[model samples]
Target: MGLRAKKFTPEVLLSAPRRSEGIPNSDASKVLYSVSTYSFDDHAKASEIRLLDSKSQESSLVTDKNGSSEPQWLDDDTVLLLHGDEGGVTHIKVGPVQHFGDGSYIAGTIDGPVGNVKLVRIGNGTYGVALTGKVKPCGDLYNPEKAEKPVTTGREFDSLFVRHWDHYTTENRNAIFLATLYKEADKYKLSELKNALKGSKLESPIDPFGGTDNFDISTHGLVFTAKDPDLNPATHTKTNIYLSASKNFWLDIAKGLPEFFEVPISNFEGASTSPVWDKTGTSIAFLSMKTDGYESDKNQLFVIPDYVTPGWVIHHFPGGSSGQGTWDRSPQSIAWGGNDTLYLTAEAKGRMNLFTAAARPTGLNPVPSQLVKGGYITSVKVLNSGDIFLTSTSLIESSLYSTVPADHAKRTLSGQSYYTLPVDESPYDPKSSQLITKYVSSSTHCGGMFGIYGHQVSEISWPGAADDTDIHAFVIKPSNFKEGKTYPLAYLIHGGPQGAWGDSWSTRWNPVLFAEQGYVVITPNPTGSTGYGQKFVDAIQNQWGGLPYEDLVLGFDYIQKNLPYVDTDHAVALGASYGGYMMNWIQGHDLGRKFKALVTHDGVFSMTSQLASEELYFPFHDLGGTLWNNSESWSKWDPSRFAGNWATPHLIVHSELDYRLTMNEGLSAFNVLQTKGVHSKLLYFPDENHWVLKPENSLKWHEVVFDWINEHAGLEKYTVWRAGNVKKQPEDS
Candidate 1:
């Protein structure tokens, strides 16, 4: 029988193999990683830790029973993972990396559910296990089963962060815990867990999306970051780093709780994160932003060398002062290549490129050299052999592994490497010492899925509507695209207002998914969108409906005039968060007449009502000030003011848990559209947040959105294409 052809659908996207960063072992001989894919039969995501042989690029599943995650290399051959049991209890499992299922043992247990656990080496060959878990007020590990049940469900808060991203604040905050880890009689055992931040009123691994990146440990001690307890979380973004030195250089005995010392940050303030310690633990390097309230400020690399010694100096790279930086791009991820070298993954133009810089430079202007160009480098690891292991993604590929030879003698410095920025505004720039390696393609991924349906991705730039500065955008053409055939345009605006459309893979707002539906997808990185520079990102402030909206207009006009293959007349626009707000803005503006339909997900209907939204810093910084003081600016950009002009068929998707924007925004927009007799539909999800993440809900979202756009664009409703046959897929299906 002929092999059944696979088409890229929401189901395919939801089930596509998702891989974690490929982490190299001590010798660089093998790589350990995790892969997760949505299982339709199980109605949940199925994950497995896999060990990859670096030489042959062959990977074997280490464990899949009960779906394991967070794979770490305990040594050159031993693997550590958080595997779940049949009863859904997470266990710290250890096994030989080479052996699949034999000689594995349940190492130990934590007091509560563990998140982000890692083994750190001490001075005397001893390893200390550090993890983040919740603790009670009495300095004991928090156990939900033993806690007293409350009679009332009511919550009272005197602070601004009443509700973060999705959940309400509780008494138990995420804290770092440290314990001695060792093997006895071939069985791993953990000592009594001690609260690393015992007396601190701050939460390490600051909420919403914090993880292992927030803290790091080495032989010297532990270095972690936590929000300042004195500052208001709603309006401030200051997360200071704290260090706790191990007893006698390496704490071996179960002694007193370690004392925490606030790492003096000098003048730099803002969101300090990704505190990473080198293998020797002699220094700690992290990324920091200079501004107080601005979350999208350029991240300047800071290094604290000899942090354990007295009067340790803090070195801020590229830009030493607040809001002053010659390096325009922000480092998204940072890793130590060697003791003196630092590897960074930063956004350049549209792609996340790998770069190498001096870890501790004496020169005033230390420029970083760009390593590999193009694609998004999600994770980077420097092996003991100095080989660089990387995991990247692109518009076409979901996951890719590549290794760059760190040896200068191995390969010639030709077109592969060069300094990213100019030196002294000179005409000539020297090449880097390293060479790029070919990508290690995924062996398990089906070629038919991406090769047959992957969109042709390219970046296009045009003069901005507000200014002559070139504004960039990503254009994705359907794989089945033809030269003569014109396709409907799917204009996608990103959220963040501080975010950009980069060459990266995303489960949500995927360009490939949109283009697969026979549409030309265009995602614009307008003013306020990051990666362009801090100035460009700051341009959107106080001009939410002003410059950004004009930039979109210019972007639309550019396509309509140049790209004859895109049917701009039947185009549809979609966005979430700030993008959602733009959709509402577009609905009430002249741009509304161009699009056949519009989609706004968790958008702001009225600027005045946005005060009710959480994260006061966001609206406070972007809208100029509070509603009371910035009334004129708020009313000027408010989408609700122009609600009478709404006429385009629209879809409003809002969730009950979206505290960032709240459900009222979508509800108010829908009410306005309905009151004006505009063709509109509201897709409400009580279980969802700002974004749709659940597998089943995502599929339903795609179906409803496709139906709405297809109906308005005079196209047929979406249908599943099987082998040589067109199968009708109902709304439920």
Candidate 2:
């Protein structure tokens, strides 16, 4: 008989506070980060900014304002904050105060047309990137729905990607504009902004993945930008380098004359992105991929000290690997260190580890020196004295960490203020040693999700494939879990097959929500996962399904055998993209019988269709070659081939505008289930893209998913109902 609705609900669980992101000050003296607060029920929630004072290790709220993001520190005294102000509009604000007292002051009110803003010191004057929207005006920065837009065609779409991811494309061009910053008696104001990229068709700073690294400023205040090579707005995404010597350099161009002072850099054989000037500003360092049309190509770190010459005097760092010995599936962000060295974080062994290399060419191969070997580190900075400040995250906790060259001990200056990093507490008496007495307490953001605590997070490792290589997985248990209590399994497989379920908390697929429903969640990073080493990541190619599937199966078996609390009979498998493909594959594998149900979100159901995807390189590289030459490899792993035998009830979610996988994949999978007459449901989001992002939609998604799992896989109470029947779950022998 069908059971009544239970006490568990998505209301409280979805409200769980999660860490939004972390940003470090230029001086490494303070850290600014945003965390989710559930004090309000709005799914379109904004994060509160909190500052961590490194010296005092004291944490204080900067902006209690509901959803701030992109926290950037201009200096020890100034910080730049961009966040949703009113009606889901992004507002940029920079202030003289270090800590948010009266709260965050919006800087764009006088700066310029608010767009994507970044602040860089240009000589004695301050400069920023914003949209003036004068030529093509950005009429609003607060509410897109009510945005007083300029009347043109008013036609929403003159093209593709009019609706990107979750929201419709705004008229804003995200151009780089100059904010006239001046000081009046100890007081300052940023106003009189104008478009700087005059006579340019390129988007300012380049997007959709561009960060602050997308553009850089020289000591002389000149700006260097890597713009996507597309001039006519093509589907293919690749970037090219451009530079402006000074503000007046573009004055002639802005007047519609080709007399612009700026010029395009050397056109390379491939895409060049993330340009940064050296300390001396003599040369620049950027990551270049030799092959065009492919985003996954291994990067070659190139230094162009002679940018003014006819072509870049390209110098390749011979020793280190692409992405600077790190696997950057996207454009790699690199930082400059003392002695002209570059420090980067690479995906290695399921961790985002730190590595460093010099800018100048070395005679031998550049094998980067691995520094911070554990946890996930991003936004690395090097001091003149060789000190490093970065943000690190693990399965359970995340915070800003500092390392001095002397001892290299990670001083947890933020989050958990552990002067003594985990597992390395000193033996000396706490009273005798200069020890920090208190830890950064979990924020109000933590202990959220209807005030229900998250699972006890930990890690596990298992062997894989023919080599029996070690694979890592982040495992979670229901809050206040007891060893004797068996719980349903929520096997959450991550995408990127290149990405790992690392120590840091995730907002999208948080294990805490599953734990709140009394389910044990296991996020596995199989053969293709990053931070494992280049060889491991490279192994996923050609053998996509062959090896990674073996790793997943064996890892699941290991977890089931080891963790008796997992009710395997009532388990449900869920994944997105690559993980989704794995879930589809699982439908045909013997593992299909182990799970009560499955969920594939925007998964790759057919390689044939994916080859024609908006992105061409990922499929071209991962499948070894083009489909014509490697038909066998493509067919061997295509999840669609196994759909004929699918028996388990499944939920297929595909966004209509998911150009990456396209909507056909999910539709095809759902069609097969319908044809086979198996129990299934299909969720189509016409507004969303590859991921569900709209707050209300995301909330509904969580509710529906949990309700489905409740009926199909026994979320909390082990009431498994499969294939339209309440399957008798096998009890402990």
Candidate 3:
């Protein structure tokens, strides 16, 4: 027999190489991207900016510094990179893309660290740059000096946002700043910067996950998104896009234009983001939600026709009915294919697929058609030649880059045929429609250092908790597999009650990693999952522990009845965030007794105490109301109510810095299990937030988690400490 394949253990998983989106230059001749690799020797990560020749498929390191990131192209052959100095000051360095490392020179420096910086050419010699930086209480750039400690160490706030995801809120807020980058005395110099929201209370690129995607700049003006200043951020999800007519960077273009004023572009009371300008700079397109409080509402496409002229109209491309053909999915990110055609990436039937729409003349509501499927399209860029550059990831690949020509052939698969695959059918069996296939053959692959890992991935659907509904799930078989051999089951529940398990790759809770450990991993997207449609996504509202729990139960039964390879009797279940909540839910019910063990990470123990979460709007929307008015709603599906049934071996993981679901949630669950005399362990991280992001912490997290499950499954444990030379426990202590 051939040599056995290497197991992707926690150590190997931590060291897996990663690549960011491939950013193509003007003519699509070269691409700039970043590669990240973990160094267990230092318990740190090292990143390098690399340049790839699109034609030759050859790449070389541009910068070896770990601090460098977010490289942007200044022109066809020039690049700008963001880096932080030893003093923590942020600098933008510019140089020719061909000049690997030494030729780059500092273009400009900000007073402090900034994020989401975007540079655009406005005229023949002038370039404009926009960035989000923290502004201090003194209305000046926030730096170490401005952040010096006061006599009083305590912080006081009059707002509802006393703290955010990880840290307490201060007077400092992130604001958008614009400046012109020009050459002076043969050295690049930035002109006096102007604050986009000078005296306004608004802030650009809302906190937590917002970045450069929140704003866009064109030769005509600048457009950005900011939350509604009048509404309480803790309860509302309204963000609007603002447009500035004053061409601050180009005075010639500013003349005869509307007076320099920043004005709201849309009146819609919902979340608006991803503002982008067309190639001609005559129109703008973005995605927005209509609901006021629901953060997960369906995103509607909107475009501004003839924005440069007076009396511009904001046209909305409606879904469902507004004269448009029936389109049920929501677009997550958008880009202009040309002046009129729009390319979008949206979740569809457990996959993040690309679609094409139109930015029309008027009164025309064109439905978005699926242009490409399979793999998660993380980012897309349309070149001037109408070709599309895409960066995507899938269960087998870490990162991928592809170029689809404007006149590419489309393989239109019948939705009925693709969706009607048998529950036992392997995703690869339907190769033409199911496998992760790029639209065009011109593709580059990176981070596939270990080959395809010798595993089979499949997407299968089973009967749902409700009639006429089906629940979808992704399954991964162990790397080393024999036909008739059975494997322990690792049932993983996704965190977003609003999220779905798709053809995507994730560092945390990776199904491939579990499969490598000799278990059959199944990630089920039951009720409340997106990609199915908005109705299914909204089904979990106020029904938290009802439908989704039943769907998962049915999923387990389906595996037991059909997939002979999956041994449900010898199984363990794990989840984080909402998934964590499901684990606690499973514990209190009959499902808890079926699993050999359970792991809950940053889960919710009690819905009644969910008010402790930072985003009050999440609870407000998901739970239906507040504690005073809807006490029954909060207590109906509370996991604490079912704690008496806990008996399985349990691992509770919670991070101290997770303000979303406070540490108390996990600690409370551990306490309940202990009180019930159940075998349990608590893995607490004081430095982590809702997710374990640090490399070292992540490695430890996987080790402890895998060890717990392996112990219950009768497999070799993975914890390194168990092998260390430690004193044996006293017989009688």
Give the TM-score of each candidate: 0.92, 0.76, 0.90
**What alpha-carbon RMSD in Å does predicted model 3 have with respect to the real structure?**
5.8
Q: Please write out the lDDT profile of model 1 over residues 422-521, one tens digit for every residue.
A: 1111222134343235444442232244444233877789998665578899899987899999999999999988888888778887887888788999
Q: Which stretches of candidate 1 lie over 4 Å from their true place?
A: 1-5, 85-89, 123-125, 318-322, 408-436, 443-448, 452-455, 719-733
Q: Write the per-residue lDDT of candidate 3 for residues 420-491, one digit (tens) a residue.
A: 111121222334554332322122122234334423788789999887899989888875778999999999
By lDDT, is 1 or 3 better? 1
lDDT ranking from best to worst? 1, 3, 2
Give model 2's TM-score versus the native structure: 0.76
lDDT values of the candidates?
Answer: 0.77, 0.61, 0.76
Ranking by TM-score: 1, 3, 2
Worst 10-residue lDDT window for candidate 1 reads: 420-429
Candidate closest to the true structure, highest TM-score: 1
lDDT of 2 by residue, 467-572 (tens): 8488888778866688788988889888876666775544467666676677888888888776565567668888777888888789879977998888888888
Each candidate's clash count:
0, 21, 0
Q: List the residue pairs that clash in candidate 3.
A: none
TM-score of 3: 0.90
